[model samples]
Target: MADSVGFIYTFFLTAAVIYVSAIVIIFGVKEQPIRSKEAKRVSYSRKDVLIHIFKQPLLVVTMLLTFITQVGNFSIQPLLALYIHDLHGPVNLAFYAGLAFSATGLGNLLFTRKWGDLGDRIGHDKVLLALLILSSILFIPQAMADSYVMLVIFRFLYGMALGGIIPCTTAYIRIKAPASMQGEVLGYNVSFRFLGNVVGPVIGGIVASHYGIPAVFYVTAGIFLFGALFLWAVRSHAKTNERSV
Candidate 1:
């Protein structure tokens, strides 16, 4: 029976991979004619573009905020299953764990594009600030949640708030960064994100061991609030400079 189960699992996994690969091969290949248009838009050399991006206050601060927010967002990831257990979850702990984990993605998927559009219409920085504050508020309930259902609900809302932040940051970058270096700056943002992923769990584990799981949520909420304030300062400084000029 065990051998049969293993064989079936492997067979389905292999079939899924092949199916996805085929779809990608069929539909994913495209030649971008926009490359020429992009090149024509920016006359600066790559080195100059790099230096300009590095010197931009908005880009630097946005990247830092990205790092901080990602760290806070993912800090509780490794503890979610254990948290469910603490809540005295239903018999299928694994199922609840999966549900709690996926709830964030579902919320993110639903809200990301809407937030992106809103950012485009209004202002990315403003939208990002609002989302950060909202996310921080949502984390409070998550930290205090006593039931599995409540935890899932909070996670879902947290995810929705988080889903808006990254795209807003990206939109801000595009508006402020030199067109030639936008891709590189975005890549750096992604690196910061991964750096946060690396550090979040380690720091979370230490905090959880010392204080408790709930404390992790509290800490993350504080971090998000701090990041929002930092972004606000940066935005304010920019406006002040613009007015003075």
Candidate 2:
């Protein structure tokens, strides 16, 4: 037992040393030159920059959509295992739970690039609308899943739908934002995404505890549906050329 424990400790220590050594070596190398153009003198103050970002309806809408999607995406992760168990899944409950959890990632990985290319061909808004609606619809089966296999299959399909979201969002921002402000827009999008990640798990735990596991999926689906409706409204509003409605 002592030898086994020592081996495990030694393995971790070796990994740590290798990671640190790589970092040190990389840092020791000369840094690459910044290829992007340097900013010229500007009259804009900090407040002006803040106002500019806030004034752009497109940027605000993109960030909101990204946040909503992230919240919906992770909302079930904390409760997935418990939900499967509650459904009276197979005897190998742990294995199925792990499979269900991993299926989403596998599906996402397979579909991400294809969705990105599709968004590039079509408009981002159109792609976003489709993905949002499809993802919400896929969640219905998850909420009503009678077996572990069903849950995994639904989650996998949901993930494929989700895979398009970030790329399309980023592509939309790049297309809309000024070159100088694009980085700032992306940074804000990331901040909102992480905020969603932090908030999602807490909300999921509360909803599951109070309303049971299935309720979590129902609520998450509703949120995604709401996001789709909101996106539709924004797109419609953007298309109105007249000053008056």
Candidate 3:
């Protein structure tokens, strides 16, 4: 009976979200000019754009880091409900699970724009590196958590770290992409992100089932660390290139 109620509640909530999102997108599209110079100027040869992207090592690194971080971040979502149920029994797990998952989305809603503005004001790479390190550190508590409450706390902290990542990544790409090829670059970036989202949950579930819930956190941490290291390497290379120039 409780599970049935929870399912209905979740279904309605999901439908509400979809409805709101559709409305926002509809209104947003109506507000935009149907055609503009900026849109018209968004033309570039494929070979030339590819060559330009290859030349910009930092941008490539940023894209790779973004993909890795997103995969790690999203991988745990599908298994979170199961994890909560296993830790605390299934009685009210759905409510708690929704709260845990929604916490991250709420955090993102509140912080993403702020982080994007901050990234624009400061440096995207610097903000991204900090977020990666913070995310990695926060995953420690999550991996070791013995109770649902502890997991929730860790997940909230994780969400806070996650809140800043996407905006900063998008800002980094915008700053690094050639003005002429921005559209193509952004399109590719979006595709990669979607690819990460599709794969993360499956991988997370498999690893958690095989190894343990804690392994999920450890794996996420490792992926974030790798992204951070890669970004740091790119930063170093950028400095060297600037010095040479």
Q: Model 1, which residues run further than 4 Å from truth? A: 1-27, 35-47
Q: State, as a TM-score between 0 and 1, how close model 2 is to the true structure.
A: 0.81
- TM-scores for all candidates: the values are 0.87, 0.81, 0.87
Residues 92-138 of candidate 1: C-alpha lDDT, one tens digit per residue: 76677878878998889999999999999988888999999998899
| Candidate 1 global lDDT | 0.85
Q: What is the lDDT of residue 159 in candidate 3?
A: 80
Instruction: List candidate 2 stretches off by more than 4 Å.
Output: 1-48, 88-94, 242-245
Candidate 3 versus truth, CA RMSD in Å, comes to: 2.8
TM-score of 1: 0.87
Top candidate by lDDT? 1
Q: Where is the poorest 10-residue window by lDDT in model 2?
A: 34-43
Q: Write the per-residue lDDT of candidate 3 for residues 68-135, one digit (tens) a residue.
A: 87799888888888888887888777787888887777767777787777778888888889889989
For model 2 the local lDDT of residue 39 reads 30
**lDDT score for residue 152 of model 3:** 81
Clashes of each: 0, 0, 0
